[model samples]
Target: MTIKLLAIGKTDNKLLASLITDYQNRLGHYIKFEFEIIPDLKKVKHLSETQQKEKEGALILSKLAATDTLILLDEKGKQMHSIAFSEYLQKYMNSGIKQLVFVIGGPYGFSEAVYNKAQGMLSLSKMTFSHQMIRLFIVEQFYRAFTILKNEPYHHR
Candidate 1:
C-alpha cells in the first residue's frame, strides 16, 4: 500500500524541513511514501475561523481521490504505540488498501465535512505540536514503525 501525508501550508523552518526530508528518505526504503503540502488560505485576515476552515477543507478534499482511504491527524483520535501502529499498517496492507492518506488540518482544524469524510483519526500525542512539526514527527514514526516491523536496528524496543 502507498502511504501519503497531506498537510496544510509549508514548513518555513529550514531545520524542520531538513529533518522531515531525512525521515522521508528513510521511509522510502520500506514503503511508497509521499508528502503533499496544501498551500495556506489566502486573505485569511478577512475570513472568519469557520469560513477559513471551510475553504481549507474544500481544498483538502479536492486533493483526494475516490479510492483513497482518508485519515485525519486529530487531537481526539486514537493513540497507539509504535509497534501497534506498524501492525495497524500491516493490516491495511493485508486488506489491500491502495492508498492510505493522512491529513493534518489547518490552524483552526478541519471542517465538519472533512471530519465526516475520514475513515479514521489518529493522534500522535495528547499534547499539542505545531502542524509543521507534526508532519516531521509522523514521517519519522512511519519510518520507525517499518524498522520495528522488519526488526531493523534503527528502532530499539
Candidate 2:
C-alpha cells in the first residue's frame, strides 16, 4: 500500500523541510510514500474560521480517490505508542489497501465534512504542534514504524 501525507501549506523553515525530506526518503525504502501540500488560502482576513475550514476541507477532499482510506491527524484522535503505530500500519498493509491518506489540516483545523469522510483519526501528541512541524513529526514516525516492522537497527539506534 502507498502511504500519502496531505498537509496544508508548504514547509517554510529550511531545517524542518530538510528533516522531512530525509525521513520521506528513508520511508521510500520500505513502502511507497507521497507527501503533498495543499496551498494556504488567500485573503484569510475576509473569511471566518468556518469558511476557511470549509474551503480547506474542499481542497483536502479534492485530492482523495474514491478507494482511498482517509485518516485525519486530529487533536481529538486516537493516540498510540510507536510500537502500536507499527501494528496499525501492519494492519492496513494486510488489509490490501491501495492508498492510505493522512491529512494535516490548516490553522482552523478540519471542517465537519472532512471529519465525516475520515475512516480514522490519530493524535501524535496531546499538546498542540505547528502544522509545519507536524509534517516532520508524522514522516519521521512513518519511517520509525517501517523500521520497527522490518526489524531494522534504526529504531533502536
Candidate 3:
C-alpha cells in the first residue's frame, strides 16, 4: 500500500525540514511514501479554535479518497512500541489497501468530524510535541519500522 502523511502546515524550521527530507528519502527505498503539507489556515486571529478546527477538518477531508484508510496521529490514540508499529504496517500491507493516510492535525488538534472519519489513531508519545517536530519523528519512525521489517540494523531491540 502507498503510505501518505498529511500534516496541517509547512515545516518552517530549516533543520527540521532537512531531517524530515532525509527520512522521506530513506523511506522511499522500502515503500511508496508521500508527505503532503496542507497550507496553514489564514486569518486565524479572527476565528475561534472551534472554527479553525472545523475549517482545517474540511481541508483534511478534502484530501482523502473514498476508499483510503484514514489514520490520525492523535494524542489520545493508541501508543505502541516500535516492533508493534512495524507489525501494524505489515497488517496494512497484507490488507490489500491502496492507500494508508496518516494525518497530523492543526495546533488545537482534530475536529469531531475528522475523528469520526478516521479508521484508526496512533500516538507517537505521551509527551506533547510541536507539529513540525512530529513530522520529523513520524517519518523517522516510519523509516525505522521498515528497517526492522527488513531485518536491518538501524533499529535495535
Candidate 4:
C-alpha cells in the first residue's frame, strides 16, 4: 500500500525541511511514500477560528477518496511504540489497501467535519509540537518503523 502524508502549509525553515527530506528519502527505500502540503489560507486576520477550520476541512476532505482510510495525527489519539506502529503498517498493507492517508491538521486543529471523516487517530507524544516539527517526526517514525520491520540496525530497541 502507498502511504501518504497530508499536512497544512509548508515548512519554510531550511533546517527542518532538510531533515524532513532526509527521512523522506530513507522511507522511499521501504515503501511508496508521498507528502502533500495544502497551502495555508490567505488573509487570516478576519476569519474566525471556526471559519478557518471549516475552510481547511473542506480542503482536506477534497483530497480524500471514498475508500481511503483517513488517520489524523492528534494529541488525544492512540499512542503506539515503534514496533507496534510497524505492525500497524503491516496490517494496513495486508488488507490490500490502495492508499493509507495520514493527516496533520491546521493550527487550530481539525474541524468537526474532518474529525467525522477520520477512521483513526494517532499521537506521537504527550508533548505538543509545532505543525512543521510534526512533519519531521512523523516521517522519521515512518522510516524507523520500516527499518524495524525489516530487522535493520536503524532502531536500537
Candidate 5:
C-alpha cells in the first residue's frame, strides 16, 4: 500500500527539512510514500481556537481519498514501541489497501469532523513535540518501521 503523510504548515528549519527528506527518500526503497503539506491558515488572530481547528480540519479532510485510511498523530492516540508500529504497518499492508494516510493537525489539534473520519490515531510519544519536529520524528519512524520489517540492521531490535 502507498503511505501518505499530510501535515499542516511548512517547517522552516533547514536541518529538520533535510533530515525529513532523507528518511522519506529511504522509504522509497521499501514502499511508495508521499508527504504533502497543507498551507497554514491565514489571519487567525480573530478566530477562536475552536474556529481555527474547524477550519484546519476542513482543509485536512479535503486532502483525503474516499478509500484512504486516515490516522491522526494525536496526543491522545495509542502509543506503541517501534517494533509494534512495524507490525501495525504489516497488518495494513496485508490488508491490500491503496493508501494509508497519517495526519498531523494544526496547533490546536483536530476538530470533531476530522476525529470522526479517522480510522485510528497513533501517538509517537506521551510528551508533546513541536509540529515541525514531529515531521522529522514520524518520517524517521516510518523508515525505522520499514527497516525492522525487512530485518535490516537500521533498527537494532
Candidate 6:
C-alpha cells in the first residue's frame, strides 16, 4: 500500500525541513510514501478557532481518496511502543489497503468531521510536539518501522 502523510502548513525551519527530507528519502526504499503539505490558512486573526478547524478539516478531507484508510496522529489516540508500531504497520500492509493516510491537523487539532472519517488514530507520544517537528518524527518512525520489519540493524530493542 502507498503511504501518504498530509499535514497542514509548511515547515519554516530550515533544519527541520532538511531532516524531514532525509527521512522521507530513507522511507522511500521500503514503501511508496508521499508527503503533502496543505498551505496554512490565511488571515487566521479574523476566524475563530472553530472556524479555522472547520476550514482546515474541509481541506484535509479534500485530499483524501474515497478508498483511502485515514489515520490521524492525535494526542488522544492510541500510544504504542516502537515494536508495536512496527507490528501495526505490518498489519496494515497485510490488510490490502490501497492507501494509508496519516494526517497531522492544524494547531487547534481536528474537527469532528475529520475525527469521524478516520479509520484509526495513533499517538507518537504523550508529550506535545510542534506540527513541523511531528512531520520529521513520523517519517523517521516510518523508516525505523520498516527497518525493524526487515530485521535490519537500523532499529534496536
Cα RMSDs, all models? 0.7, 1.0, 0.6, 0.7, 0.5, 0.6
Model 3 residue runs over 4 Å out of place are none
lDDT of 2 by residue, 1-157 (tens): 9999999999999999999999998898999999999999999999999999999999999999999999999999999999999999999999999999999999999999999999999999999999999999999999999999999887873
Per-candidate TM-score against the hidden true structure: 0.98, 0.98, 0.99, 0.98, 0.99, 0.98
The lDDT values for all models are 0.94, 0.96, 0.96, 0.96, 0.96, 0.96
After superposition, candidate 6 runs with Cα above 4 Å error: none
Off by over 4 Å in 1: none
- Summed over model 5, clashes come to 0
Residues 48-104, model 3: lDDT tens digits: 999999999999999999999999999999999999999999999999999999999
C-alpha lDDT (0 to 100) for residue 121 of candidate 5: 98
lDDT of 6: 0.96
| Per-residue lDDT of model 4, residues 1-157, tens digit only | 8899999999989999999999999998999999999999999889999999999999999999899999999998999999999999989989999999999999999999999999999999999999999999999999999999999999998
Off by over 4 Å in 2: none
**Candidate 1 C-alpha lDDT tens digits along 1-157:** 8999999999999999999999999988999999999999888999999999999999999999999999899998999999999998888888888999999999899999999999999999999999989998999989998988899998788
Superposed model 4: Cα runs more than 4 Å off: none
Return the clash pairs for model 1, or none. none
Taking the tens digit of each residue's C-alpha lDDT, what string does model 5 give over 1-157? Answer: 9999999999889999999999999999999999999999999999999999999999999999899999999999999999999999999999999999999999999999999999999999999999999999999999999999999999885
